[model samples]
Target: MSAAGIGELREGPLHAAVKDLLAVPGDRAEVRVEGFVIDLVRADGELVEIQTGGFSPLGRKLDALLDGNRMRIVFPVPAERRIIRIDDHGEVLSARRSPLKGSALDVFDRLVSFPSLIAHPNLVVEVLLCKEDHVRAPEAGRSRSGRRRRDPGERRLVEVLDSVTLDSPQACGALLPEALGAGAEAEGFTTRELAAALGVRMILAQRIAYCLRAMEVLEDAGRRGRAPLHRRA
Candidate 1:
């Protein structure tokens, strides 16, 4: 990216790094085709879109892209995060790694945002697990030597430590605490039970439930009190 075009790119360091990694043997970046700017286009015309956010926002863009291209959407998960803070005086404040790490299961959080899109034959969801460095700028109005409440406030990607892929729905089974049954499924589970089973937060479990349900990995089996129950589909 050039100095003038730097602002034109919507993605951050993680995205750009993954794009380079995903650029296949004969793929090209920033290709203009049919008046649309594609991320990467393979020699055989397959397109790749690296999305690190929710899929719901890309509905219209996908609609346009899929009309003519067989595409794949790559999502990067911060499996490990390291924080680096900088003060207004351009001094490095602190560097620390987050104790709690993310996993393949974390993809469920974004998948719940637009579940049906993954069902498209022309589109595949690729999850990339990555170690990252987050750089933050100091919050405004604080004295150079004074202690601040939040410290550096605005955070952005400064580097990518490493990244690897978990491609296809089959590969994502590692995220589940238990395997989904093959048949119409005899027993069902709720978000609460799932949270307890996985030893994760209830809110995260809810998102995982939504993704599994959408993927046809789980089926709705009425409700347990106010929450919905799901069985293997």
Candidate 2:
């Protein structure tokens, strides 16, 4: 899917999740946070902010508010997206995790989802994971003599990526599938699998996965016997 198409896919699900989370007991009706105009509400007496895009100045403002009010920020952290810094007044409240590591968004999502998180009196941050599609090499077809022929769709995807600029790993991942002419149903490659296939380091492979996940092109199959596997709507 194109970037715009991916955004469209995220809209409904994200809105529903935010609405449901806000509707829980002790959760206040959705309201705009002062100054930033971000949609937010109080849940269990703690502020909950839903963020979708990057707004550094706005994040800084929210961090400042955390010093005075109990808050929990819920946002989608794009795969491989950098975490600049979170400063709560004079105290540094949070920092981005290591570069080229597993999804930062996934780590952030796990943190706030913990049962004990609601007990905290201070601010909390949660990131939701969204899967992305995969990019594959062009397919080869057999000729009359059993010779292989190149696929046009495969060439198209690569051409697209080569023609544009990519700002992040997520962007790279998103482009790759399209560039390589891999459709949505293409057998997706896992981080480990892709790493082994490409002869790259595990960290690099994971970063690529993170980007694809954030773009909603790949899906995570959660641990067995834990959470049920993620499914597309």
Candidate 3:
């Protein structure tokens, strides 16, 4: 289903590409209210915004729109990515798949930039796992003083593989990996313990801990040296 006015304004290709998948029947897109243009308004009157970039740009818009409004933030994290390099003449040169993989925990990297927004009562965050195509101009860089000045490449939306929603504290709690099993999460754990158990660095474990804490899914248990102790609430 297509939303009215969605195609009227020029939005990024990825933004426009995602609209068709998310908008249901009777949903309005690019709707203007009180001089602000909202991304979409669902049949249930839920405000939906797809942000592919940083949250710093959303503060003013969200503050105005979120008051007494049920809003959902749809964020896409690339699970699999393929790179397509093209020549200046737009000729396809080469295509290759990237080795890096993404998981739901990756959202914390972006979420950490603006963690406070996740705690909003009227907000629901939907993390989408997607496969994307990164289009690049392979021979586009220029040399200046033995330095490479590169043109910014582009990304295209390929597909959304799967999704998970965090609508409440408990929902956020559910994202904890099996490494932190029910007993472990409930029994309290130190960052060292979490890092050692997950085979991750202490810094990574700390970021994960911060995300859970901001979401109200985890709380302080105590401290183990510089690392903080936490338990699932």
Candidate 4:
């Protein structure tokens, strides 16, 4: 995929995931604070903001608003790799040990499954992903001092998996095909094309195809070499 295309792919899904998170029940409200549009959501009787982009500007604005009020901020995992935390002042408070587990769709599932969290009226949430150009940084000695390094084009499979919310085995068997279908269509790939398009190892694609078939979400279409096809039983 071209650089722009990769960005479009990530942004589209990231926005959907953010919308899913925001849909959690609570006194949900949005406001234009500073130069950023902030979504304020309540959880556990505490005010929180989901900070997506960066901390510099957001942290300063949030600190001013906090004014001694107990507050927390949540940011989406980096490419679904891991979640990071920030205080009202936008300082990096801590990094979550694990990425939000499950398939990308599972993230949405969790948000809906946990409706009680949305009932709170003081929380704010933000969701963001690192730009493709920032996906990897060069080693210190590899670049001039004070100059940020360019991102290598290598897409990190491990990081992507970490960032995703995987479904249970049964759920995976059930939902994998639909997710694959959506992914295929979004990427303009046919089933066979999709199996080839993952850019991951062929074995991984085959394994995912196998799981989908076992779930009855896919079936062999005569001898075309086990395409990433999906169909209802």
For each candidate, give its TM-score against the true structure.
Answer: 0.77, 0.32, 0.81, 0.27
Local distance difference test values of all predictions, in order = 0.69, 0.42, 0.75, 0.40
Which residue window of length 10 is worst by lDDT in model 4? 153-162
State each model's C-alpha RMSD to the native.
4.8, 20.7, 3.8, 17.0
TM-score of 2: 0.32
Runs in model 2 with CA error above 4 Å? 1-13, 32-38, 55-57, 77-102, 105-121, 130-233
Quickly count the clashes in candidate 4: 20
* Local accuracy of candidate 3 as per-residue lDDT tens digits, 1-233: 23345444546667777877898889988877556667888988888888777656667777887777898888877789888888989898999998877766666666676565777788888888889887888865557676676645666789999998977666766766665736635667887777777656677678778877887778887765775678876
lDDT of 2 by residue, 30-107 (tens): 344454333445554566655544424344655566567766555543333233332334333343443442243233
Which stretches in model 4 have alpha-carbon errors above 4 Å? 1-16, 32-37, 43-45, 79-233
lDDT rank order: 3, 1, 2, 4
Alpha-carbon shift of residue 59 in model 4 (angstroms): 2.8
Q: Give a tens-digit lDDT track for model 4, residues 1-233.
A: 44334433433344434545445676444434344344453544344554343444444555455453444444454444433444456455454444333233222222322222222233233223332211223233445566755433232222222232222334444434445445335432334553554443444455555544554445554433443334433
Query: Which is the winner by lDDT between candidate 1 and candidate 3?
Result: 3
Candidate with top lDDT is 3
lDDT of 2 at 48: 61
Backbone clashes in model 3, listed as residue pairs: none
